[model samples]
Target: MFIMRNISIMKTFIRRRHIYIDHYDLSSTGISLNEYHQRRHSLINLIRNYIKTEQKQSSYNFTICLPSSTRLFMGPDVAYFPFKQQSDFYYLTGCMQPDALLLLNGNDETFSTNLFLSSCPMNSINDYERWYGPTITDKDKICQIFGIDSVHSIDKLNSFKIPSSSILFYNSQITDDTSTNKKNLIPFLKNFSSSIVCNQLNHFLHSLRSIKSLTEQNLIRHACQLVSKAFIKTIKNCKKNIQNEYLIHARFQYECTKLENTSMAFYPVVAANGRSNILHYQNNNQPINSDDLIMLDGGCLYKQYASDVTRFWPINGRFSSSQQQLYEILLTVQKDLIKYLNSGDKFITRGKLNILTDQYMIKYLREEFILSRTIDDDHAKRIINYLCPTSVSHHLGLDVHDCESISFSEKLESGNVITIEPGLYIPLDCTDVPSIYRGFATRLEDDVLLTDQGCEVLTSMCPKEINDLYRLLDERDNSDID
Candidate 1:
């Protein structure tokens, strides 16, 4: 999927291919040479609009500094975690390397993107190249490959004297300071120009990122589909009541990797029984007891896009009488909430979801004699959170929890992909809680894509229906008998 083109501006030029590793898929990422150009152009328009609309200036000239991965780590320095490009930087340049900077020059005459890279090691010049490896250091070749206007040495960035009153945008975390590892601009502001203006590119960039392009949708859909298959298989494996949480977690990883060279979006939460009461349970070491209700919170990443789907099921292949009652309530609330996510629907904020869910659940609890009939509105809401400690929905995409630049009451749009998760958790030691509902937790989550007509449940095939869960175990039993 990644290959350097033969021809370049330099006649018969050779690229240093050994040290340069490109794992990113351009087609899947909706990132290409053309896409980069379009993005650069779009930002140019955004700047122009900002200058005219807000600043009331003719135009706001600026230069953006986007640093690449430092590949730096704590402790062992064996690169403990895999190297991933900073999200906003990758979104703009799509360059995968260590110690590189993308400077987007936004001037009146020219809106050109420039690349600055650290020197690559060579065997003849240094011993590090022989032991460490060869990297892409060729200036012309780097330009040709990455589709940038100009390329320079990393040291040139150090000597980058900003123009007086120049707006230098740094792509770093949205902190009060403008420094994220290599792209520190504090020294530039303090030492160099007193009048130089600094700002973060977070909000401006997120505005574009929040909306998924066609290519992004395809990648996300593929990720969700793969995760769905893996989750179904993992659930079926648990029905025998012989597997531990780690085994199920391992099974999910194995299935995702075997199907397609994919990776986990985040660590799997194969919490069984009372362990499900804890929201972020990473320790999947417990055994699956026959009567336990297991919460399988797992997802996989395919080509950088992420998929998150969770299910609550019984180890014995059948929900207990108490489990069925609570599970049905959660399942019903989740299904009902989906109706409000359609395009033009009053934005399904966390607050709105909480209000609606609490009303429904409190009413159900009262009718079923689960909660005290004397329970007031506030207490009933607390009961709802007791079972489901997490929010009903969150944006899902490149990150498992994606596009945070959204308000809780933000209107639902066509391109948005969000998760609808309504869960119920009951701890074992809580005597205050009714005995029937204690010591079990169940959370059902699915990724939904908002469409013009309604919404498309991307992970719909994963099968949350009560019948589907039972049928899966039934099929497994039938297969074993054969």
Candidate 2:
């Protein structure tokens, strides 16, 4: 169920027969053009409310400008990375082309959204289109697809008019200051007076993005499900008992990509043995030791939504005593954090969740390791902090670390997606614990969605319990022997 549209250059408007994607579908992403319009409408209402409350202005005009990412080259005419649209721009307009700009002009309660796209050269053999294929350039077609008010060629932006006194809401951080794309959009901003009240749009945009719509929630759920299945497949592959970090990483990628419309969200951390002690270790080239525990922190993107998950398992399909002990402690800490969030009376923010996790980690560590009672609460906290220096939770969505502009102090409400990860890294040379635990690290991470009823773990399909993990490996071993 895909819509195929024919796009053509000016010279061969009638002769061209190449087809291009008009929009995404349920198989890829279920987001529709109307949803994009709704997002822009929400932004307009947010700005209007701010004007009424803060400025107390009966009526006012405003212009919000957002820019898309630019194409980057690695060497001579070779693009280094794939073109991913800027998140904020894609959220409002659903337009993924680079070097585009979105302009929202409004007065009182009504607003008009405009998209400025770069037009291709009008020659016989379009080099860009010849190599990369035709893009949606027709103004009417784009307006119909994105549900914007009007569409204009990017060159005309310099002449586009806006009220000089209108409030300017633009996020400077959306693109690099040195980028040519950003520089191109600067002239459009000059139309507004210097005295115009300038506000950062990311804070408001992120506030809306923090609460996922029903469609967004489903997309993220699908993303999490894909990653979970991929993890299981990778774990089973370890039955061979001769896999390396690189092979495990490749196995996970192959499993995820074999599915429809899925890609890795980020470079995975495939750490083995002492390498697990280094947080965010991504040099996935070391050989696996039969006695060493493996830590894999990887996830994939279904559509544009991302899933971030981490799991620890033994390379030999059985956990050692020390490995089991450390893994159980971390797993308990992760479970407690989720359980507390679900059962707690007061709404909890990320900061509060982090503090609670620290408390749980210290309590478990002290009880299991038999730390001296003489250690004060602050001392225990410091020790836990030293062990796991990364944040316990972060917002997850379009980007793995989604909605960065939204502060962690904000209370998590229904429809919000965040990761619950708690880990401990004990150095090989450390004297703080028994030698068996040293040089070992264990972590359990899951994608969670906050809801009115309770928090749901989206990555629950992947087994974390020791018994369940053992069952998976046992099956693998039995099958290999058979």
Off by over 4 Å in 2: 1-28, 121-127, 477-482
> What is the C-alpha local distance difference test score of candidate 2?
0.79
Instruction: Indicate which candidate wins on TM-score.
Output: 2
Task: For candidate 2, give the lDDT of residue 361.
Answer: 82
Across 1-482, the per-residue lDDT of candidate 2 in tens digits comes to 12233343443653232222323332234797667778888888888888888888877898888887766778887975645667888788666677778889888967788887655533432554676675554567667777778887676787888865788888867544555555567676666657465558988898999899999999999999999988888787765466578988888888887887688888898898879787768899998877778888998987778999999887777887877888888898998999987895466899888888889888887888734457899887887788888889999988889899877788898999999999888888866677778888767899999998879999999989998888777777544311
TM-score: model 1 vs. ground truth: 0.85
* Candidate 1 clash pair list: 387-424, 387-425
Give the alpha-carbon lDDT of every model: 0.70, 0.79
Please provide TM-scores, in order, for all candidate models, with all chains considered together.
Answer: 0.85, 0.91
- Candidate 1 overall Cα lDDT vs. reference? 0.70
lDDT tens digits, residue span 120-144, model 1: 3332323445665554445676677
